[model samples]
Target: MTGGVVFDPLLPWPLIATLGLVALIGVTLALWRGLSGWALRALAAIALLGALAGPVYRVEDRKPLSDIVVMVEDASASQNLSDRPAQMQAAAEALAAEIEARPHTELRRVTVPDGAGDEGTRLLETLAEALAEEPQGRIAGIIALSDGRVHDIDRAPPLPAPLHLLLTGRESDWDRRLIVTNAPAFAIIGEPVILTLRVEDSGAVPQTANIAPLEISVDGGAAQRFEIPTGRDIDLPLTLPHGGRNVIQFTVPEAEGEITARNNTALVQINGVRDRLRVLLVSGEPHAGGRIWRNLLKSDSSVDLVHFTILRPPDKQDGVPVDELSLIAFPTRELFLEKIDDFDLIIFDRYKRRGILPASYLENVANYVRQGGAVLVAAGPDFASADSIWRSPLGAILPAEPSARVIEQPYHPALTDLGQRHPVTADLQGEENWGSWLRQIEIETTSGDVLMQGVEDRPLLILDRVEQGRVALLASDQAWLWNRGFEGGGPQLDLLRRLAHWMMKEPELEEETLWAEATGQRMRIVRRSLGDEVGAVTVTRPDGKTLDLALEQVAPGRFEALYDGPEIGLYRLQEGDQKTVIGLGPAAPREFEQTIATGEVMEPLIAPTRGGILRLEEGLPRLREVRAGRPAAGRGWIGLTPRDAYETRDVRQTPLLPAWAMLLLAAGLITGGWLREGRR
Candidate 1:
């Protein structure tokens, strides 16, 4: 119960003040004239004025409220390292027990878990939500159990009571981490790109741990070791060996006293792309299909096209000078000898060995294919003639050799069994309506894949890989009929683009490859092969555990599997001779990025509230209660504020003087003073 004095004026304050001022003036005048009743008049006037003020004695019945004490628990992944989780559990239970044993104190437990994606630990955000629910005046204290590796430090809310952090982890804790500071999203194939990375040592590191052994691996191959200096940035120069998504892992061998090996490794996936597709088109004779090739090549912004058409053969020696003939001599020497290796792809559109290019030039073209260059041949009826380019040294690299026969029957093209399993022709199965080719050269496939068959099931399209380069041969020149919308057209554009890109070694068009792409926790894995029977893929997780996943055929050559990852890290996928690496959420999660714990992040917020940050490494400090504006923490103990808050259950008020009592007293005093004045 609490008691206080309150007022309830009977009349307006202005009128009551005027009446009192008039009485005071009259008493002052009487006192100045030596009136004997001046004292009595002043006493009666004082009591009357007191009655008008309506003073009341107020007594309140209040029930004391329980002071709320909040306990914030950090259950993030970082806190689980070493014995920190155990430390947090023990500290939280002990703190809860102490707060519970206290008289009229309520304990509020707020748990902060590991964040999804790369959010790490949003400790402050969770604490703020808990603090917002309670009245600030009733909060006696807030205690946090964390590793001090909070990600949202800037979001700490204004604290009302003393805030204490019982930090986990030992003073001797140390950690080594691999940091990928800068990485590019895409890099040109066969070109060296610099990746910025570093290996750092944090916490109480040893003196001899200045150098860490870094292991680097591309895809899922064997790791290569290098000694890298700790605590400094290092630029790693990498050249993508193949085109497509390349997974590069930079790791450091785990050391003693380190928190975890999760941070010792970092994964980076850089997509490999061709900077330019340089195509050289050689034409022995100009035809309608030559324009199709030119238009297709010219349509792509990344392709640089060079066209050379033999307007007049060497045999057609017209009676005109070379200059006057309005023809520029073909630079066969420059194209085949000077800078042949610089070209990415060479196209032979009905090209014949008509002495325009010497036998040496043909041999050089063959050598170019063997030395990592792509060649595509669009055969016509002339390919079956004795003047065909197949008679030259280029025949060694060609997939098919014509038998000097041309079949001139209109027939629709068809995909062979191998084509159904080849990425280049996989999507062409059961095409709605295909255009027909009127002429096709008869040829036998020798050391190449027959992707398409013509009349009598002859090899129409063949793809072959030479030494390091790739080659393709098309037996018909009537593919343009599809482009012209014959019989509602066929997939002519799609087929040509795929064949060209495949010859150029595009990773997406590889006949045999395994790779995975991820969005958040969902991963879509793919396996491409040319064989009809494909086996399951073996996936190795970041922890060296393996699982075999059976693939489902999505398309002819595409095998797919969808998996939801339970954790964030690098995943290694392998199918037959193919192997690749992929990162799910992060190569190294944000939670493990900095595993060492410290109290600097919450010091600013704790300081303003006179709170103390004590580490559990030196034994959990004892908790106590303290008054506001005083020291809230000491060497061996932490303090909570004594709120002294209460709820008023009932209230009563009684007037100090009743209206009748005030009137009788004022009249008796006035009458006694007047009679005394009259007698005098």
Candidate 2:
């Protein structure tokens, strides 16, 4: 208990002098001619009047409330990196015990959890929330246990009392991290994209330069290795061969003298799509489906399709002389050989040999297929006739030999056994509204995989893999019936798109390939195949653990499974013999950039408040009592400021001596004074 006397009214000297002025005025009026007796009487009256002014002093008993001590602990990802986690745990326990030992003091522990998706740790935010619940006067001091890498520094609350930092890591603790300085979200297919990356050494760097070899793999294949300089940034140019999400994994062999290999590897998923796909469509004769193919391809803004229809062949000569003909000669050699590489895809729609293109020109077309080029043949009834282009030099590369037979029968275009598994024609189960093709061409294909079949099990569509390229054959050439909705056709656009993408080496179309997609914290593992069943899928996350999962078929040929990652990081997947890597989080975090313990981050707050910072390793400082609004710690030492908060469980009030009592006392004194004066 404590008690003190305080004045109710303490007037300054100026107010006292003003009262004397009024007395002097009264005396001068009473004795205008040099009055000594009146002046003396006036001074005595002034003294008596000053004593009558009400001034009171009272003492109150008070009991101080318990002080509040805040303890902030960092529980972020970086805190769990090395021995820092154990160190922090130990320090937190010690600080809590010490704060609890203080008399009449309560401890408020604030836990800082890891930020979501590379946002880093928010230490200041936790402290501010803890402070809002307690009274400012009851707060004694604040203690923080962290790596000093807080992302929410701007949210630090105004210090109600002294703030202290008890840092968590040792001085010799070091780290090495991979930094992707530059990466693009989209890159042109088959074009090289330049990426800027670096390997940085923090804290205590290794003495030896130990330049490690950097290996890069696209969609998880054999990695190409290159020597990279250590402790500095380097530029790497990478080319993507196919379209869609191209997963590129960059890794450097773990150096002999490095801290952790976590930062030695990085994964980037960039969308690889063609800037423009140039296609040459040669149509021997105009048909309904021919216009459909042209229209569908032309609608896409990314496709550049050049359509050419032959009105007449060069060998055709009527009764009129060659001079009478106004047609210009077709540039066969220029298109097939001279500028062949410029076009990405070439389509021969019902094209027949007419002496317009020599056998050597056809041989050049076949050679183009052997050198990583794509070609497609759309055959009609003429493909089985004597004028078939297959009889030319291109026969060696043709997957099917046309039997001289024309089956003029209506049948629904059907998918073969393998077609149901192929990505292009798979899952096009048009059983609900099966469409019909009016015409069917009889063709005998022994070597190629039949994808679509028509009338009497005749091969309608055959797909073949040639030397370093892909070729597709459509036997009937009556696909235009689907475009015209001959028998309630389904989505014709979908079929054509899948076929084109499949021929372009889309990763999703591979018979045995591993791929992963992230959907807001969960990753979906997908494996596509042409076979009836796929082997088990294996997954390797950023944490370096492999998990083999049995795939469940969701569609006709697609298998998928969901894997929930514990945290945001890179993940790798492997199914059968294929592998892929992808990043599920942002590049880096602000706190992970610096794992060392330092008060530098909070130095500005500490210096202004006259608060001292003491490390846990240096031992906790003794609690001290200091004046309010004064420095809690003086000169090179640290201390806590105590606030004297009194609790009033019950207060008593008493108003003594009424106005009538004062009036009665004044009347008696006046009467006595008058009697005394008369007696004198």
**How do all models score by TM-score?**
0.89, 0.84
Where model 1 places Cα greater than 4 Å from the true spot, the runs are 1-4, 8-54, 358-364, 414-421, 427-430, 453-459, 531-533, 659-680
The C-alpha RMSD of each candidate to the native structure, in angstroms, is 3.5, 4.8
Model 2 TM-score is: 0.84
State model 2's lDDT: 0.74
Best by TM-score: 1
Give one digit per residue, the lDDT tens place, for model 2 in 449-512: 8988888888888878888877888887777777777779765677777777666677667766
Q: Which candidate is the best by lDDT?
A: 1
| Candidate 2 residue pairs that clash | 289-480
Task: In model 2, state the lDDT of residue 419.
Answer: 81
**lDDT (CA) per prediction:** 0.88, 0.74
